[model samples]
Target chain A: MLRGFLVLVLFFLLGEALQKVFLIPVSGGVLGMMLMTLTLMFKGGISDDLASASQGLISVLVLLIMPGVVGVFFTADQFAGQWLAVAAALLGGTFLSVLSTLWLMSRVVRLGGGKGE
Target chain B: MARVNDWYSRLLSLPETLSASPALAIGLTFGAFFAGNAVFRRIGRPLWLPPVVLSAVLLAAVVALLGMDYKAYQQGAHWLTVLLGPATVALGIPLYQQMHHIRALWRPILVTLPIAATLAAVYALVIAWSLGATPEVLASLAPKSVTAPIAIGITQQLGGSVPLMMGGLLITGVVATLFVDLAARWLAISDDRILGFALGLNGHAVGTARAFEISPTAGAFASLGMGLTGVFTALILPLVFHL
Candidate 1:
């Protein structure tokens, strides 16, 4: 447990360092993840204990959305009053995004046409 | 008693007959989500599956009908809010398991992460600004593509309204999900890692969920993307928005 906490702390610190030294646009923790991931790679793979601990934390990552869910409680009124604007924007955005992804997927398949799908 | 009424009021605060419990308020909020998620899944609606959204809608409706303030509802909702850190810390596990796979692609991650992060951050900012959004809102909207908890914190740090930031981020996540693959397809984007990671990094949980729907490998990339993007935004947003 202590190790996991320490590892997390390390990521936090390293994330700060990477930004200062490397000029990366992404965060230190992310850099930390990249760092951790790299270390795991260097080791050839994670130790079973490290893997287990990491996995345990990842399991319920979804529940973290709860706090965010609460955030919407405040935005509800703005949504109600100008739903058309929200709807129009979200709808337009969703349409453009999905269409673009599907198009890419199909093209990829066509290009890989030589390979059996 | 007046302080309670004035400062941190509960939704079910009855004046005549008093039942002073925050649980009831939280139950009402969660019950809406639980029920909405159930109904949406059963009926098989597109928007229903992500109960986070549906729950938000239902909670709003209940509050409207009850004449409750967002703050009042928050008395209970705050409990759920506090759990975000635990949830964030928890993401380390799946990431740990995927370490071997991620390790094999370190060079690509190092090279591509910066490029993708720059593009996503700039793109959102340009769009929001071009649309005539104010500076503070632009900062909030800029990080919308990443996951919620981190995005929320980033926006708040940068001086955006937390709730507005949350709404913007949620909408961005959903919008990014619907289009990332299609956008990549349009650009002739072929590498799943490039396509998946870019979207996951930019779109956050919604993007990751969509990636998971496509493939486990893609999902792994998506997770990496979320982890990477959140980390980047944590560092970068403060710099960009703080100024």
Candidate 2:
């Protein structure tokens, strides 16, 4: 637990340093994550300090789904009226995304000197 | 303060408005999207009916109509973002579980990681350029498809003047979910492993979830792709942008 808190705090602070001083574009939270990842890599396996600290927090990641869930509170009425546009964007984006990326992915694999067949 | 919040809340909750809670609103929109998806699927329609995209679009529409600031919506969303830490940490657990396979795949992963990362960014830039998007947006969108917090970091550094790369992440997730299977099939990639990883690499969480639906092995690879992509993007994007 101590390790987790310390690491999280440490990473965030360092991230802030990079953000403020160096003006690195990534979020501090991410920098913190990367810092922690590096710590684990160097140390080779989780310490009791690291595991206990990180485990509890990692469990409820799903709760982050709330705010977006909450965004729906105001959108209830608009559902019926603009459902078409919403549907179109959703479907259209999905279609384009799937077709384009799939095609590109195959070409990429082949270009990389690999063949699925 | 509570009273002030309550008064403003009441004003916002007028029948002329939508739901008062962003969380509830989000939950309900997804609920409706599921229903919509059910309707489409029942009729044997295309799988292009995306629940997340549909739900988010529906939410954005109401925000536009009600003149609700993104701030108010995010007030409710702050709860969600706080969970990001735990979510990322959980990634460790799954990663540990798959350690053996990870060891075996390490070589290929190293070689492929940079290539995949570069392609995702380049494609994003290409699309924005084709669409004639503004420079700020192009810059902001470039590092998207990496991961949320990291994307946010890069966006902040670039002075992109936009919300973190999260919005773009969300879009990528929804898109990845819808198309992962199609891509896998199109490539004639017989292995589910490759399909899942590609989707997750390109899509992130949504793709990861889709990978889970396919099988555990695929899900595992997807997770790897997601994690590796974030790390690679962080290290390499700055170098690429500099060049």
Candidate 3:
């Protein structure tokens, strides 16, 4: 588990390094994910240890954002006057996005001869 | 009277310990999340009681009650904050695991995921702008459909408010998780692939979790959607918006 975790950390650091070197706008974590995905694809698969370590970390992924969420909560007063606008935009935008994506994907899959179960 | 004064002094000093030590903050985070998870389980895992949201609320209440400010809480919670990047990198494992399934539908996924993500971003932007939202709020809402870590990056690059971005993400996740099933039923969308993709696209991690509860194939496709959407948004949004 320790080795596996170290590998993940190394990938993350590599991602950060790449981001700095390339002046990319993307986050290091995301670039790390892309790197790991490519590694897994080329390497055939992950070792059991690596797999377990990743699983352990991913399982509590939501917990990692608690601090940020709490930060938002404390500063929520900044948006107090605009709650209505924010709500309308988020609700309308998300609902429409989901609906449109679902509609378009189903159509594309059908046209591609993929069976939809 | 002397005993009451002593208790008051101790209470005042509590923040010094809890809000100054990384270990204590980490412990508090885990303890709060554990309690949230327990409550979620006890409530039969309702859609509204997401463990993250519940834990954040619980933690925030505790912080408020203790008179500890956000900065102090953040200082002590730096350990967990640092792990966010690694945890996001860890998401690659599940995405890698689903590579076979993704490969089979690569064409559709490749074509659809980017469009879906762009559509989501544009929808939020246009709607928020039309609703008279500030540019800051619009920027924050633009990345609301993506996962939190990537969303935060996008928001920062776009000069949006991170707090607003986090709030937008939480709202999107909860709404998608709660409404996807009902909306699907209303729209008569019984196709697992479509349902899964929609969940993943708009809901991110939380939506993907809901997809898993439906079926393994749904879960796999949901992971694909989530991963592809994250990549697409991170790579494209900055360039498209000139951020």
Candidate 4:
């Protein structure tokens, strides 16, 4: 598990360095993810240690992100004048997003002659 | 005699020293999270009260009660936050595992990802624009559906406030988690792959977490959706704005 963490951190750091040198728009973690995916594809399998370490981290993803969510409370001024706009956009955008994807996928599945269910 | 006195004084100041240390913040977070988890389990884990949300709300309340600034709390919590980088990279495992599913539906996924992602961003921007949001706010909202790290990067690339982007991401996630299920039931679309993909695309990591609760297939698809959406949007949005 420790070795797995070492691999993940090394990939992440490399991704971060790449982003810095190349001005990549994506986050280091994301670039690292892509890089790791490619590497795993090349290697053709995940090691048990890496799998366990990664799963351990993934399992508590919420805890890792919670501090940021809590950080939102302190930034009240940023949304002071436009809470309604933010609220509407979030609600409408999310609902529409889900609906559109669902609608599109089901329509495509039906056309492709697959049982979508 | 002097050494004993020194030890006694140190013991007396232990509470203050502990509070000043990083462990306090870390302990507070995990303590709140486990407590929230306990409460969630006790209450039967309703869709509306995810442990993360409950924990965040509770943690915020506790911080406010202690008159602690978010920065001070974050000083210690940053240790955990740094793990997000590795954790996100680790997501590759699940995404790679789902390669066959992705390969099978490559056509539809390829077709749907860009369109769904574009629609998600545009709808939020248009609605917020119609509702009188400032340009910066709109910029921040543009990446609301993407994962937080990538969303932060995209928001920065677009000249948006990190705080607003984070806020939008969190709320969008919570809203998506609650409503997507309702939308699925309403649309009568029961394919975990499709449903999970939507959840990941619109909800980002929070949605992805919820998707895992549904099933491993859903989890895998959701990870795929999130990674692809992140890559696509990260590559495209900045260029669009640059133009």
Candidate 5:
């Protein structure tokens, strides 16, 4: 577990460094995820340590994000007078995006003869 | 009489003293989370009442009652948020697990990613624009479909407010989760991969969580969708704005 955590953190730090050095638009964590994915692909498998550690962290992901969500209290002012618009954008956009993605993917599977089905 | 007065004074000052302690913030967040999780389970885990949402609401109320400032709460809570970086990187595990799926459908996955992710952002931006949302709000909303850590980064890059981005992210997750489930049923689509991918692309982490509940295959696809979408949006959105 410790080894897994160490690997993840090292990859994350490396990702951050790459982002800073290369001016990557994606966040370091995301870049790290990509790099790690590539590394795993090349290695052809996952380590037991990495798998368990990653699962442990991913399992509590919601708790990690809760602090940021609480920032809603701070942004209450931003929502003032635009609540309806914000609400519509979030609700309408999410519904539409889900529907579109579902429809498009289903069709892609059919047309391309993809294995997703 | 003096003793009673002294005891009352100590009691009155207790909250202030506790609020000053960073541990109080950390403890409150975890305590609330577990309590929220317990309640969510007890209530049969309603789709709308995710433990995180419940925890956030409960924490907000508790902080208000304690008269604790958000900044003060953040002193301890920030440590937890820091873990999000590692967590985001750890997504590689699940993505790697789906390597077989990727090998089989890389082309379809690639084709679907750009359109789905772009639409996710564009639809929100268009709706918000039509309704007169400010540019900053639009910037924040643009990355709403990605995971929180990635979305936060995109918001900063765009000079949008992180707090506003977070609000949009949370709501988008909840809305996408509910709608995808309903849409899947209404459309008679039972493929877990498609369901999970849509959930991840549109809903992100929250949707990914729900997808996992359906099945591991769904969970893996959700992870793939979320990771790819985050990378794609983070790479593309800023370039589009620069143009």
Candidate 6:
């Protein structure tokens, strides 16, 4: 498990180095995830070490992100005036996007001869 | 009454010792999270009762009530923030496990992922812009569909406010996760893959977590959608919204 975590951290560091070198706009962690996915694909399977380590991290994924969410308290006052606009945009936009994506993906799947089940 | 007042005074003075301790910060965070999780589970895990949401509210309330500055809390809680990158990288495991499915349906996923991502961003920008949101807010709202880390990076690159972007991301995740079931039933969408993809594309990490509760296959597809959407948004947003 520790080895697997070290490997993940290595990948994340590599991603950060690559991002700095190439000036990629994406976050290094995301780039690292993409890189790890490719590595696993080519390797033909997930190692138990990696699998267990990742599972441990993924289980508490929400906990990891909570710090940033809590940071919102620092800037809550900024949105006080635009809360209505922000709320409308977030709620309205998210609803429409989910609805449309579902509709489009299903249509495309049906067209491709899959049951889309 | 006098003893109660002394206890209250002692409680107020506790921050003097506890405020600077990382252990206290971490302990408080975990305690709040577990408490929130207990409440959420006890309440049967309603859509609006996400553990992170509850925990955030709880933590914020505690900080405010204790009269502790946000920065002081952040200083001690910084360790959790450091793990965000690794947690994101760990997402690759699920994506890897689902590789065969992804390859089999690459045609549809490849075709639709970009379109779905673009539609999400465009809808957000248009709605916020028309509603008279300021430019900074517009930039932040534009990336609300992507996961929080990537969204924050995109927002920074576009010169938007990070805090506003975080708020937008949380709201987007909660709303999408909450309404996705109803939207699917209304649209007659029984395909778990499509539903999962839609959820991840719109809701990001939170939605993907919700998708996992439904099925592994759904969870896998949702992770793929989320990863691809993040990559696409990161690549495209800077080009379209050049500073």
Candidate 2, residues B1-243, lDDT tens digits: the string is 999999998887652354356664455434545654556466675545444455455556655666766666576556557656545544554455455665655555566667766777776666555655555655666666666656656666665533424555666676666566665665566565567677667777667766766776676677778777876787777777656
lDDT of each: 0.60, 0.59, 0.80, 0.86, 0.88, 0.84
Error of 6 at B112 (Å): 1.0
**TM-score of chain A, model 2?**
0.61
Candidate 4 lDDT over A1-117, as tens digits, reads 999999999999999999999987789999999999999899999999999999999998888888878887888875788999989999998888888988887777667734333
TM-score leader? 5
For model 4, the local distance difference test gives 0.86
lDDT for each residue of candidate 4 in B15-54, tens digit (9 for 90 to 100):
4566677898888899888988999999998987778878
Worst 10 residues of 2 chain B by lDDT: B159-168
TM-score of each: 0.68, 0.64, 0.92, 0.91, 0.95, 0.94
Give the poorly placed runs of model 5, Cα more than 4 Å off.
B1-7, B19-21
After superposing candidate 4, which stretches have Cα over 4 Å from the reference?
Answer: A113-117, B1-20, B241-243
lDDT tens digits, residues A65-89, model 3?
7877787788788877778778887
Ranking by lDDT: 5, 4, 6, 3, 1, 2
Q: Could you give the DockQ of candidate 5?
A: 0.79
DockQ per model, Cα: 0.24, 0.17, 0.67, 0.68, 0.79, 0.71
Candidate 6 similarity to native, TM-score: 0.94
Question: Could you tell me how far off, in angstroms, the CA of residue B37 lies in candidate 3 after the best superposition?
Answer: 1.4
> To one decimal, what is the Cα RMSD in angstroms of model 6 from the true structure?
2.6
Report how far off residue A15 is in candidate 2 (Å). Answer: 9.3
Model 3, B1-243: lDDT tens digits are 999999999988887766667776777788888988888898898876787788888988887877877788788887887887887788788778876666666667767887888998888787778778887787788888888877888898888999778878888887877777777887788877778878888888778777878875676677667767887888888777764
Candidate 5 local Cα displacement, residue B173, angstroms: 0.3
Better of 3 and 6 by TM-score: 6
lDDT of 6 by residue, B15-34 (tens): 75687788777787888889
lDDT of 6 at A97: 88
Ten-residue segment with the worst summed lDDT in candidate 4 chain A? A108-117
Give the alpha carbon lDDT tens digit for every residue of A45-95 in model 6. 877898899888887877777767887777978767777888888888888
Q: Mind sharing the TM-score for model 2?
A: 0.64
Model 5, residue A12: distance off in Å is: 0.9
